[model samples]
Target: MAIRRALISVSDKTGIVEFARELAAAGVQIISTGGTHSLLEKEGIPVIGISEVTGFPEIMDGRVKTLHPAVHSGLLAVRDNEEHQRAIRELGLDYIDLVVVNLYPFAATIAKPDVTYEDAIENIDIGGPTMLRSAAKNHAFVTVVVDAADYEGVLGEIKQGGDTSLDTRKRLAAKVFRHTGAYDALIGDYLSKLGGDPLPERYTVTYEKVQDLRYGENPHQRAAFYRRPLASEGNVTTAEQLHGKELSYNNINDANAALAIVKEFSEPAVVAVKHMNPCGVGVGADIHEAYQKAYAADPTSIFGGIVAANRMIGEETAQLLSEIFLEIILAPDYTPEALDILSRKKNIRLLRTGELASAEGRKSDWVVTSVEGGMVVQESDVHSISEADLKVVTERQPTAEEMKQLLFGWKVVKHVKSNAILLAKDDRTVGVGAGQMNRVGAARIAIEQAGEQAKGAALASDAFFPMGDTVELAAKAGITAIIQPGGSIKDEESIRAANEHGIAMVFTGVRHFKH
Candidate 1:
């Protein structure tokens, strides 16, 4: 299997002239099509056009070129078989020792801001993939190259001996099929999106590796981060780490959780997350007041947590944050004085992401979780309930101030792990009970945390109370009002308990389970 003839066709023409010159100097005949032939000819290299090799004119906008029997018979012929060689000799087809091809820029074309459907469809290459597949299938005798990066290495192998080794040929063949498969997947995804079907019968997504983390959630596991391309919005995956060491797996998870919760509020807000659950959330007139309220919510739980702010962080907020040992501080931007103050803590990771989008403008609406052998995908819990959406179910109606506190707590409760309960006073979370197995257990934990502060505070439950026990306990803990979905079978019993204890209760008509 000597280097008798090679075909070259590509959309990206990097380092092709030098590699082709080496091949031609070694007595290898170069066969090219269209742009590649013109490029090689201008570079003073001898080449043969594809039409000459196929003995037919390229027709139909050059879509029918290199699809004839002459090209396929040469690429698919088995060099070691005497019968195959005899058929090749009788058909007068020269042996194609190599195939160099890359598909059209379908992905980049579709990513254009104003690309049309007809333009995308026209960029799909037919003859290139066909020729690559033919050469790859007969890789035991033919060499196929899809990536320009492999051009020099391929030339090195050919110059070492008369042909590329069997092992290298097999590896290159595998690369050809992989390239074609990804190209086809991109086309399928683009077409399916045009048809208004986000989820097709078969779904395929592509991601590029961003970085390797220090480890997974634990020290014994390995992990890496990847992100989807062509994303225009800023998120945790799109955030820029301005200072400190590389982020850990748990750091990224908690940061993302904090960012999501902070994005729910329009006012200046701060959310502190621990173990992927919001331990503290506060919204105020400014970021300094927001940070102060959030830190006052649960100082112990905020020790090693991640904090995110929806507004620019100031010097006072940074100085207060420096008192705690936080893993990361994320914000839309930080003042020069604030950055100077926070820079004192060398290990604290600082992330500067752009402003958070509104609830309606958020992009991450799909949730994915993995099981043992597969994954479950569903829409995200971006549910929002307005003030008018709440229905008063008890004899006593919540005051306007209590309703505001309840809404603040409700926003924080949705980010907590279920069964969840959050107690808020003055637009800041005072206590949170998350990841409990029962409703009453979660309520007790939150009440115990609030103690004297629970008096006159509003309670927000992520889901409905299963029985009157939670209401009875909340009444004993001095909780003045409660807000829940009110869809439980024992809703009447809970309402009666609320009325007996003189506690005002409202139903949101929607649940915010976050398990």
Candidate 2:
């Protein structure tokens, strides 16, 4: 179809002037609503107001502007159908060939801390979505444009071929539907929150396509990355890739896990992650020593895992990390020599996650998981258990050194799966039993893995022990003090077992269930 009429309405007016000028030069009539019409008129572009087409002035706070039949009829009219063409001519409606519309800034508005509920509701664009969906529905006859970034390419294609291609129209139509759907999802989520529903009446998620991966978890499976609608200001996903090969699916997953753990520390720290679990984590006076201690803690597991450092990667630290076969290394900055040495590795993925720590006192959002037909969403387990939060439940209290081991084990236990138990001594994890069928099984596996190291080590459980058997087994393995989230009904029996074994026990009141 030849370009004839173009309808333009947008809250974001970037590049609109030049786009309007080019369309006018090509003999295309421009019809726009309130703000867009005024903008085009100021630039000396001949433009007809939407009110002129609809025979009604914009009413009710401009909400009733483009919802009329004339606007949609022109967009939906089938060029080759006699009945459709007859109805348009009989109703005195002009055929609209192109629609350039972008919705209001609902996401940006809601991001403000002091934004009122009424202000957010007012920014919701009803007419824009209506026009976009109508034009997209008739994409065979009308081309729809939602993003300003697509304007240049579309205009270039139209200028080269004297008309937009049918394939281009259809592809743009799909983008239009996705755009409107995302907008609706945001609105629904906000309304659901206001109504105090635990879960949204409908799932409203928006993701922007990031990249096409080489493959998924396996080579045969296809994969691509789509980021959440709003980019987290200083998150790993928004990090810059300084050098190295493109990240694989598993690399991104492990890198994210490493960042999550490293973000917990305020001091100079380094964390090595393997298979979504931390192999080693250390805090030191300098990043070099932190990386050294972390690597030495579990040299075997750090072989091909992801490494994340809270501080910048120095040349000395980079030299130590280069000795290992790591899949990815991430930090805020890298020294020139450090980047040079790390770049020598052909397949290592290096990322510069500027400021990996969350802003002061900012709470991290919940992580949501989807399974089968249901969704699970809960607050992030980023809250650290402080010494003040631990309450001694048994007759004996934990000694000073055992308290440090208890805190270290508590941090490690949060990353493990449910029915999880971790045994640690002197800030190093001795053994871990994660995702077992029962708590007793978890305790047995942890103790067996620890072997002789289980003696005098402190234990941490993600949740309360339902029975006394776990404590009995821990005592048999020579455990000293245990820390757990105590809320079970049989908690008294577990406390009695700990007292009988002269093992100090503390309840944190908070659970760190990872499943």
Candidate 3:
């Protein structure tokens, strides 16, 4: 199985020159097309042009080259079949032993901020993918290379035995299909998006593998991380780990939850997350004050929790954070002294978020969840409310201070699991009750967590109270103000209970249920 001929065509010519030179030195005749042909000839390497094999010139802006029967038969011809051998001898078809190719930069072209439709369409490689798939389909006789990273291993195998092993060819062939599948999916996604149908009847999206994690949520399961190519700034996937051990499945999930909550505020803010739910949240004049408030929000739960901040972590803030055991600390940046102090801890993951300012508050569009047999994709919850948006549904109007706390609590409650309740005091969360079976049960848990802090705290519920029970519970805890989406059949009962307890209640006519 000695190698005699190879086809080399690529858009990403990282090691093409050296690889071609080595292949030619091994007595393998190289056939190339377009830019690849010019490059090999310029490098003083022996080569044969594609037109020389196909007996036709490149036409239609080089789109019709290498698409002739000669290239396909060379790549797909069977070496062991007598009939195929007769066709190869009588019809003068040659057998290609190897295919070195990579698709055009369709993903990169669309990623550009101002990329045009014509530019993107022109970059799609037709012949490259065709040759790759043809050779990949006949993996028993031909070897295919798609990634530049595989160059060394393929070259070593060829140098040793003059051909790739069956296992190597199969693996490379699998990679070729994945590469082409992602390429085609992206092109389809772009066309659908341009046609003003982002989530078409057949929804398709593409992601690239980031890394393999140690385990899944549990030690018994395996896991890996994949990143969406067009993900915006400040996403957990874009975080640059500065210090710590590798992130686990739970760590990435919790960090993403924390980032979602922190991204809601324009001011200096911090959010603590555990088990994909916000345990504590705070907003203040500076990062230090925000950190202090967040730590005090749920001191017991904050231990080993994921924390995300919108502002830079200063030395003072870092000093306080270093005093505790946290799984991860994420922020836009950190001071030199702050990094030095935090880096001293061996296991805490410190991530510096990149380019949050340019995100322009376009947080996300689609939210996806995985079920057993399939997945669920829906539009993300980007709802926000202001003072003007609140309806005075109770007898008492919320005071100025109570109104501020209500708004803060509302934002935090949105990120919590429903049935959710959050109690806020001043500029920080005092307690959060999430994932309960009923509204009253959730309020009781929130009140218990707040303890004495619940007396003056304002409460925000993710949904409307079914009856007066949750309102009565909040009243007993001395909650001064309440905010929720008010559209339940028993809304009057809750309003009566609030009025009886002299509590101010406002409704935004909107719900924030996170299931």
Question: Which ten contiguous residues of candidate 1 have the minimum total lDDT?
Answer: 358-367
* TM-scores for every predicted model: 0.88, 0.89, 0.98
Q: What does candidate 3's lDDT look like per residue over 1-515, in tens digits?
A: 87799999999999999999999998999999999899999999999999999999999989999999888988888889988888888988789999999988988898899999999999988999999999999999999999989989988999999998999999999999998988988899889878988888887777898899999999999999999887776778988999999899999989988887888888889988889988788899998999899998898899989998899999999999999999999999999999999999998999999645422365448877889997899888877878999999998999999999999999889989999999999899998899999988899899999999999899999999999999888989999999999999999999999999999999989999999
Clashing pairs in 2: none
In the range 366-385, model 1's lDDT, one tens digit per residue, is: 46677998777777888887
Tell me the TM-score of model 3. 0.98
Q: What is the lDDT of residue 172 in candidate 1?
A: 97
Residue 96 CA error for candidate 1 (Å)?
A: 3.5
User: Which ranking of candidates, highest TM-score first?
Assistant: 3, 2, 1
Error of 1 at 31 (Å): 3.4
Query: How many clashes does the backbone of model 1 have?
Result: 0
Instruction: Report lDDT per candidate.
Output: 0.89, 0.86, 0.91
Estimate, for each residue in 243-352, the C-alpha lDDT of model 2 and write its tens digit.
Answer: 88888888888888888777776778788888887777776788997787677666777899999998999889899988889889999889899999999988888898
